[model samples]
Target: MSVKIILAGGGTGGHIFPAIAIANAIKKQQPDAEILFVGAKGRMEMEKVPQAGYEIKGIDIIGFNRSSLIKNIGLPFKLLRSFVQVRTIINQFKPDAVIGVGGYSSFPVLRFAQSKGIASFIHESNSFAGKANMMLGKKATKVFVASDGMEKFFPAQKIMITGNPVRASISLSSITKEEGLKYFGLETTKKTVLVVGGSLGAKSINEAIDAGLEEFEKNNLQLIWQTGKIYAEKAKTRAEGKFNVWVNEFISQMEHAYSAADVVISRAGAMAIAEICLVAKPAVFVPYPHAAEDHQTVNAKHLVEKHAGLMVKDNEAKEKLVSSIIALAKDEAKQNELKQHIAKLGVSDADTVIATEVLKLIKK
Candidate 1:
């Protein structure tokens, strides 16, 4: 019989895409391997996983509401119910291993699997780990972390630094810079800035661009702005035409955007940082301040401290994001320096490395 692996995690694309990549790796190693995904009901994973050609089961789960105490009243019941759901799913799937990629749903699935003495693995994508993954690290057979010095969060013996697995689109983008510009309907001669704040969008970054639209034109720069869902219409109305800007809710083909970009302004999420490094884009990160333990900032600081990138705090984004990126775009010297440094930090084959490691443990 082929090996059966259970994967869990996801609220955002950051967690879901990595989980899918690992699943694909396992499938490649053992074509007959049975893979299953567990995610929170109504979460992005519920839709994305199936689209990736894997089966996924949804559990009743949610995280604590830090901003609203009253919203957490149903927390205990939801958690308990999710555990019950996990138990049922695991018993039915009978997985040889469970892999978690850090999200609310991961807690229940891994916890239940650990209790049954089944092997469990964890992928901590952030430089600063989440509370759930830190707790799961104690018993997980292997813990895959994005950065080192994570002994503070997980068992030192179990931790393996694999870096974050980026999408194959970015890892294998062979399109030339000129072709990339053509893909975005922009001139190769004009300096271009790409703005991304993850799939849902970052208000601060969007507002920053909205505040500085005139400056970009004055600076003779073009923009390919991904305003996310929240500010799509708002940015569209604000940026309607003039032949120099492309504004949308999401850029479905991000590899092209990354390829076309001269400079990028974005949120400092782990996955975002990984892709930016892979593309070697000179960037200014505005960390999502509310991320657990301010990890977005921590992730950006890791690059900034190495002179690999720049950081503008969430509070400072509106005032500083556009101006900073514009400055870097105009200054070829600074852009080249940042590009060289950030490229040095890029781990382009992380997906293969992480997938290979997971298979190694199983093959043994």
Candidate 2:
């Protein structure tokens, strides 16, 4: 009998991509496995999953809005509706296992699956676990995590340190620096700073980089700036006639970006950190201060402590981000040190590890 699995998560590329990676790994190991993705309605996964050649079901789910209490007034209604939707999906898909990659959508689907006594798995990619994932971990058959010391969030015995799965295009890429530079229309002799603020863009990073465009040119450094969709127009206008900058809202080809980067400035989200590690680029992290429990900072701290990366606070970015990035760009020794240390943390085969374990549980 073919194994059926449900991969649930969304709201960001961080969650969506890892879920897809796991799905791909499972398909590779068990070609006959029927994989379905469940995500929040109107989220990126609805579009991205289909693009990845998988079927997806969307539930009417919304997370609590911590920034504004009034925005969450209807959250209870949405949650209730999502549970009903999850039940229908569960009844129809009848998955042998449900895997929850932390997101608002993961909760209802995994909760519904657990209630039905089906095996459920939780992948907590962050050092700081989400509240929903923590709650779901109680009954999860196995919990896959990116780093060590996740015992505080889940039952220690159920946890497996599988690392975060980076997309295959990046982790397995053979793209060279010269090819990457050509792809971005950049010169080989100039240092390239790849600025990314997650898939949605970081307003602070954008503003900081915009404020320092001249500094980059003065230092003979070039930029591959991903401004997210909201900042794209402004970033393009700002970089107009500037040969030192390449601005885009999203980078469709991240492998090229990784190859082109001499140093990276990024928000320290788990998936971003994972990709940076796999790419082995020295990075300056600007943790999103508003992330759940300031988890982004925790993710950055892990690297900083190990001398794998540097960090600037979100509030401090306007003054410090650009200078720090430029200084790091100029320092070859520090750059090489960060690169070698972070490379040790990279786990290129995490998808295979998680997939193999999931398949073993199914066979048992």
Best by lDDT: 2
Deviating ranges (above 4 Å) for candidate 2: none
TM-score, each model?
Answer: 0.97, 0.99
The TM-score that candidate 1 achieves is 0.97
Cα deviation at 14, candidate 1, in Å, is 0.9
The residue-by-residue lDDT of candidate 2 on 1-364, one tens digit each, is 9999999989999999999999999999999999999999888899999999999999999998899999999999999999999999999989999999988899999999999999999999999998889999999999999999999999999999999999999999999999999999999999999999999999999999999999999999999999999999999999999998999999989999999999999999999999999999999999999999999999999999999999999999999999999999999999999999999999999999999999999789
Q: Where's the lowest-lDDT run of ten residues in candidate 1?
A: 348-357
Alpha carbon lDDT of residue 232, candidate 1? 94
Error at 195, model 1, angstroms: 0.2
Candidate 1 lDDT over residue span 22-60, tens digit each: 887777768998899999999889988998899989999
Measured with C-alpha atoms, the lDDT of residue 219 in candidate 2 is 95
**Which residue pairs show collisions in model 1?**
none
TM-score quality measure for candidate 2 = 0.99
